[model samples]
Target: MSANPLLAADCQDGCFFVDGRFVPADTTRDVTEPATGQRLGRCAIAGAEAMRSAIAGASAAQAAWAATPPRERAAVLLRAAQALQSHFDEGALAIARETGGIVPKGQHEMREAVVICQIAAGLPLQAQGQVLPSTPGRLSLATRVPHGVVGVISPFNFPLILGIRAVAPALALGNAVVLKPDPRTPVSGGTIMAEAFARAGLPAGLLQVLPGDAEAGEALVTDPRVPMIAFTGSPAVGRRIGELAGRHLKKVSLELGGANNLVVLDDADPDAAASAIAFGAWFHQGQICMASNRVLVHEAIAGAIRERLVGKATHLPVGDGASGQVALGPMIDARQLQRFDQIVKDTVEQGARLEAGGTHEGLCYKPTVLSGVKPGMRAFDEEPFGPLVNLVTFRSDEEAVTLANQSQGGLAAAVIGRDVARALAIGRRLNAGMVHINDQTVNDECTNPFGGPGLGGNGSAVGGPADIDEYTRWQWVTVKDAPPAFPF
Candidate 1:
């Protein structure tokens, strides 16, 4: 109700961008400032009718937009990128206020979103079909076709990047999108996106932003017009979407839960390892799916690594992201705070040592580091999705690799050692889809493929050229110019 320190955009009307205009739904939902539990504003909550309209709009626009050539489609995305760049400060502030994410990280996510747009713009250069040798007088071609209307269900954490990451590529591949951003961060995650695309002269009804909760997501998933779904959220919800998509026989792409780790060998620089791992674990309050929640440090340098990590954690200024003094901000909401509390408590009760932190002041959680953690413990096995890391020691390189791969997680894994060759070798033994040699685990870029096997994702990487594969389906065609001579 009061003026927010980080407030940027005013959403007094509770409007959603649908059919090329800002329209209000009959019902509205409150968007809260997570750091203080303050009601920032009311946002439109879409009902079944609104969702059906959005789906129809996307379906109606798909054929024309698909026929509009990749160069023009890419031009629209490039224009959107520029427009979004001009609104960087406002959009970043919106993200900070909604998710308690630091403004700097918000800035990074927006800029990354811009880069993804630029990358998707280049998709036009990538030829989509291949001519295959066929029987006499018969010509065959295999082509990648757009999946028609794409349903994007994005998450609250890193909303801007996650939502736009899929949307840009889907649009580039000539498919219209229906985006449902988490209700908590609708403005940053969804609203600004529509503004940019509209400014870019994209066709009306090509992009729709509906901000709501589970009901809206269900509507999007069940809509038969949407032939594909791209989702970034919890594994539980992702599995449900997978099931629903399966029944409909629709394509699905998911960036789901992760149980990642950073392995530090005795030969590595302790300071470097500590710094990288701490940043990986605490940046964005460890809400990242790729956060290095499990730390496998050699027992020889365990004490030194522990001290450095602890020192770094305790010194970080924790407060509101808008304050500009805070290194890390608060959890998303009270439920997240409770989740971390129970995880830390259960971890400590199960024999892991709480080396530092494990305290909270209201919404702000102090960065936490746990030492002496072992297998079969929640902290070591599960993804806490909070500002915490469970530290465990290993004796040999063989054991370290074994422990890192034991989680059955396939998203990301890192090996930190001075010997580049050795780390590379050890990294090869890890089972994650993305491996970092002498670096942190929480690494991703628009130029790289980011997805995994097992529970991490649906094996469909969302960046680089992989986006083309995820957003399209293959079709084979055969044409005969004349009658073929049959070999009898």
Candidate 2:
């Protein structure tokens, strides 16, 4: 039997990572594998009190962390990245076990996270602030400063990548973070991150991992000490967080849900389009926010595309990820699985044709394809975090764009066509934050500014230069040899 990969990290058995150490919580919760319902470990179920303490700890550590030299801060992030790289295999397995991602999905997320950490390492050293034109005797400048304490709330799907994308940059820019990973997948979502940073010799209290439920999340958002919030989750929760954070007057970066689209033009090859559709709509069981929830195909090729998609869905391996025998893993939990079934049934009732899938054994939902799905159907309107592909056929490019943009979400999108220039033009018309000309919707890079307009995000992006802007505030200063005469 293989050893539990989570245990190898040493922090997954239980307890909250507070003030530089793992402190046992008053209450604990069992961590189970979604695929097999096997107990992986236990984790602290931090309540409001514990979450506040963690925030306080971050507040106490903020100044010192900010005062550290840029090179030193950069070095720490680099070392943390290296530490994460050292445990790549262990981390991937833990992610797969905890979140029900297939082995490949786990590996991809692990890779992206590590790269993002490394990219963040250079953020502190980037040119910050600027000298402004001033009166002859005076000098004026604007400098970037940390936000003191940032609260990060991450979801179960793509936990490592989503959490680290914010946490690494916030810490890199000298801000402290109090992370609240989803309670369901605490080990991979937060504990693994804490271990990597600790191994890199990060100072005490700089990053506090508080694995908790909605209460803790709410507490983190409402707390006055945490001036910034970085959250990635469903739109409903994102709305609540936005409202609470707004009332608190906090600067929040909400990387919310997406009903992403994949457009297959008439000129696109059926085989290639089908392959991209399968990967986009079903990868990680379509748990990704960037997953292609809607497939908009030109009417001429819709039948051929549907046939290929059904063939792909029917043959996809579905089972427990730990077995290493499945292409599609289980849903994150039973609740999500139930939601998937209900969405498919409702779409069918709305006149969408279910050509394949629409079934599940345990948490492993079959990859589903629904043709003739139109606007107002639950599958077309709602963001699906499962393997259900809603195919909408359009006759013209204008119509394709209309169908794609009908969803409130304007996240990642894709345009598949052989005419590069025409495809680019169509991609530009789409409202998505990121567009793939010849590819699918599920693509991201550490350097890409990844956030969309509309219901998908708040327009505040996170990655590359965007991080520098999101994690810092501007401070203007003026210096003079003598005091300047005042108008008063």
**Model 1 residue pairs with clashes:** none
The C-alpha stretches of model 1 lying farther than 4 A from their native spots are 1-13, 482-488
Off by over 4 Å in 2: 1-12
Model 1 lDDT tens row, 1-488 = 22332223454248888888888678888888877778988788987778888999999999999899778988998998987787777778778888899999888888898899899888865989899998777789999889999999999899989999999999988899999988878887888788888888989898999987788888999999999999999888989999999999989998887678789989989988999999989999999988888889999999999999889987999999876889999999888889888999998999989988999998899999999899888888788999997898999989998888777575888999988998899888887889999899889888898988777878778899688888988999999877668999
The true-versus-predicted C-alpha distance at residue 25 of model 1, in Å, is: 1.5
Q: Pick the candidate with the highest TM-score.
A: 2
- TM-score, each model? 0.95, 0.97
For model 2, how does the per-residue alpha-carbon lDDT over 356-470 read when each residue is reduced to its tens digit? 9998999999999999999999999998789988899999999998888787766799999999998999999888888999999998878989899877789789998799999
Alpha-carbon lDDT, every model: 0.87, 0.89
Residue pairs of candidate 2 with colliding backbone atoms: none
For each of the candidates, give the backbone clash count.
0, 0
Range of the 10 consecutive residues with the lowest summed lDDT in candidate 1: 1-10
Cα RMSD (Å) between model 1 and the true structure? 2.9
